[model samples]
Target: MKRVGSFLGDWWRLVIPYFRSEEWPIAIALLIGAIALTFAGVGLEVLFNDWNRRFYDSIQNKNETVFWREIIFFSWLAALYIMVFVARAIVSPYLRLRWRRWLTSHYLAHWLDDRGYYRIELTRAVDNVDQRIAEDLNQLGQYTMTLLLGLLGAVATLISFLFILWELSGPLSLASIGIDITVPGYMAWVCLIYAVVGSYLANLVGRRLIPLNFMRQRFEANFRFSLVRVRENAEGIALYHGEKREADSLNARFIDVFNNGFRVLMTQAQLAFYQSGYAQLAIIFPYVVTAPRFFAGVITFGVMTQTASAFGQVQTALSFFIDNYTSLAELRAVMDRLKGLQIATDEKPPTAIEVMPQPGRSGVATEDLTLSLPGGQALLENLDLPLEKGQSVLVRGASGTGKSTLFRALAGIWPFGRGRVRVPEGARVLFLPQKPYIPIGTLRDAVRYPDENSRASDADIAAALQATGLGHLTDRLDEVAHWSNVLSGGEQQRLAAARAIVFKPDWLFMDEATASLDDAAEATVYNALKKQLPGTTMVSIGHRPTLRKWHDRQLELKRAPGEVGTLVEVPA
Candidate 1:
């Protein structure tokens, strides 16, 4: 019961936001319309049940006139039922789509706001966030609406038919068995007990499905992600002739998917076996129980059939949980995943590193800054580095000495550290990693990335590309393609240089951004930056000796084994 309550609470938290969103007026109106159609459909069932009694009675009495009239009545009832069903079908899915759109937008904002996505990746807090946003949110909206409307319809059917069934069932007498006992509304009682037992057994048989479904989604997503990774790195793998090894890794991931999928299939098979048998038995069980009254001449055939029809409706309503247990389990799993994502995005992890903005400050500086690994081991300790405006600085260190991590700290993305990084207020900063991110779009968009709204003219973009020796790509600026996969390493780095030239940040930090380029091309790119963005402060992290000449000063990180790296000023 506690677990059920908790699940409902989580599900409600996920659902209620949409109804309260800016689209609430339309959302609520459509929901109300869907619900009205559901109840109206249930009302049609009651009318149909009454028509069943009259139509069968007229047939029993051989009254062709009344029989024909009931047929006409049934046609009208059937028409109304069809209309209600159609209306519900239209409104419900429309509401689901609109709700999903709002939810997608809301979650996207939360995930992307304030670099929450970056922190989530850094901490490894959740798995397959893309799946969560793309697939799970859609499923959540779909299942929640389907289940809620189904449940409301069930309750209405149960309430409407319970009274009709009670009145029609009358009483069961045990006088024939020598006991003087009369049970009133016996069929209603039987239905309640039968449905209760069926639901309990269904839950018992399918309880494992919740975790199985959860793991199934995870394993499937993991397998898909592995395939995408292989595709993304196809060049590296093909160059190394690692297809056999890649196949082995991919097969390993699929094995997890296959094993869990098999478990789900088997479990669903068990539930299906029980559900099918239970449903088939329900068809005749009502007749079997009500036939005695018909045979004894206590009720007409019409009364007996009406009693049976009412029994079926009441039983179906009571057995809603039994019928939908699998869907319930799946919805629970989706709720758990979405709830976890919500919590992860909402979490405000204590910041060990503090970044402050000083309005009049000339450049970026760190005070008592200590950088650490995720495991809390210090990488750099007690570092006080002040980078003044327009001063080109080169940062050099042995491999794995936290040079790139320092860049991340300055960019204010790395969180596993304690420090005060003060940046000049309103300063435009950009960090270019070794392998720059080239978004999948037109080359114009890629060159102007992180500044998608830049008003840089095509002529300016072409000039920047030519300046970086990528004059060939200038013609393809409007050509749309996956630039990251399409361009070579050197070309991609040059493209990154083109972006730097085009955007021209106030402070530019490059972590081996030019490592892929040859010395001549690299010098050309650096000279272009110097000549074009003369006032920009440049911080470069590179191993190339030729890189020193472009910088005004140098800082080297030196450390012994098991000691934190300390930054020292060195001659350029």
Candidate 2:
């Protein structure tokens, strides 16, 4: 009872969001329609059961007219049943798609909001959030519908067919042992007991598999992520001769995959041990109990067939828990992953400073700004910084000294900080990371990402690329490639700069966005920034001395013994 209650709790927690989403009306309507159709199909099942009695009786009687009449009756019933089945298939997948769409967007919204995805990545809180969103979310949505429909159909079958089973089978007797066992609805009771015992045994053998499968997914995702990391940094790895270590790292990740998979195989073998033999025994158990009466002329051939049919129905209903146990385990694994993500999304770092409102001020700004790491180590502390309209500056700090962290804080991505950041009304801010993100698409589409490609004209894109010294790319603007893989690092970095030139935001914060380029290339990117949007407030974090010349002033994070991150303003 306790376990059942807990399962219900988890199910509700997983399922409630869909019914409350913007697509609720369509989602719920199709859901209810699918369920209704499922029950309708099951109702035809009961009709078929009744038809079995009448049609077979006519056959045994050798009555041609009644047999033909029964045939016509069944034809109509079969047609209706076919209609229900067709409706179920069509509408169920429709609901599945809608649910998947809503769920993916919903999870993405929470996961990506305020760089929640980045936090999840940095903290390693959700080991397979990418897999969960892309793969598991779709499976969860689809399989959840199938499982719910199955449960409903099973329940409806059990209620309607239990009567037929009880009426068909009676008490059992073992006269050889001088024993008599009187059980009303004896076959139904036997199947119920058999299924309950079998389900318990299956769970006992398979319970460990739930955790094993969960770990297996995590391991596979880790291995895949490692491979992707290698691909992303293939040049650096080759230049440094790090192939041996990379191979060792990949081998270790595969080792994790191997061990987790071995455990799953062992547990599945244990399950097959019981379910296989149990299934083999099921083929004959009904006949052994009913054959004696049939041979003794107590029941006709039609009666024998009816008895077997009823036994199958009773057994199927009783074994619902047994059959669905594997799916339940898989569901548990998905639930745990999704539940972990939910916990992470709901969590807010306590160190984040509240945004202070100034009495006479009108735009967005921060006061007494302080930034810290997730471990509570301060990156920027007790600093008074202000930005006014048409003002631009550069922020410089040592590598990994939280210059990127400050950028994240400013963009409200990293929550582990103390700062009140304020910006003016109707101000649009864009943050450019070190590597430009080139989505897989036409060059035109990649340039205008986070906005539809149709929303931007190709001529305008060509002009921006030309201005950024990427005129060669302008001719291939409509061509598609894995731009990250196809374009050189310098070009990809410039592509981001070109994006800035095209978007023309009110403010742009570049975090080593041109680190891969040469001094000349870096100078060209900045010149493009200045030429395209001279009034756009620009703040950059870079190490090159030449970069300091691009900005009017610099704030460098100075370090000393016993001090990790202390920002010291650099004189212009």
| Best-fitting candidate, scored by lDDT | 1
lDDT value, candidate 2, whole model: 0.80
C-alpha lDDT values of all predictions: 0.90, 0.80
lDDT of 1 by residue, 1-572 (tens): 99899988898888998888899999999999989988898999999999999999999999999999999999999888888888888999999999888999999999998788987898888899999899999999888888898999999999999999899998888898999999999999999999999999999999999999899889989999999999999999999999999999999999999999999999999999999999899899989998877898989999988988998899899999889989999999898888889888887656567889898888889999988877677888878898988889999888888888998888888878887999998988889999899999899999999896899999999999999999988899889998889999999999999899899899999999999988999999999999989878999997678999999999898867667888889964
Q: Please state the error at residue 228 of candidate 2 in Å.
A: 3.7
How far in Å is the alpha carbon of 507 misplaced in model 2?
3.7
TM-score of each: 0.98, 0.88
Q: How many clashes show up per model?
A: 0, 8
Candidate 2, poorest ten consecutive residues by summed lDDT: 355-364
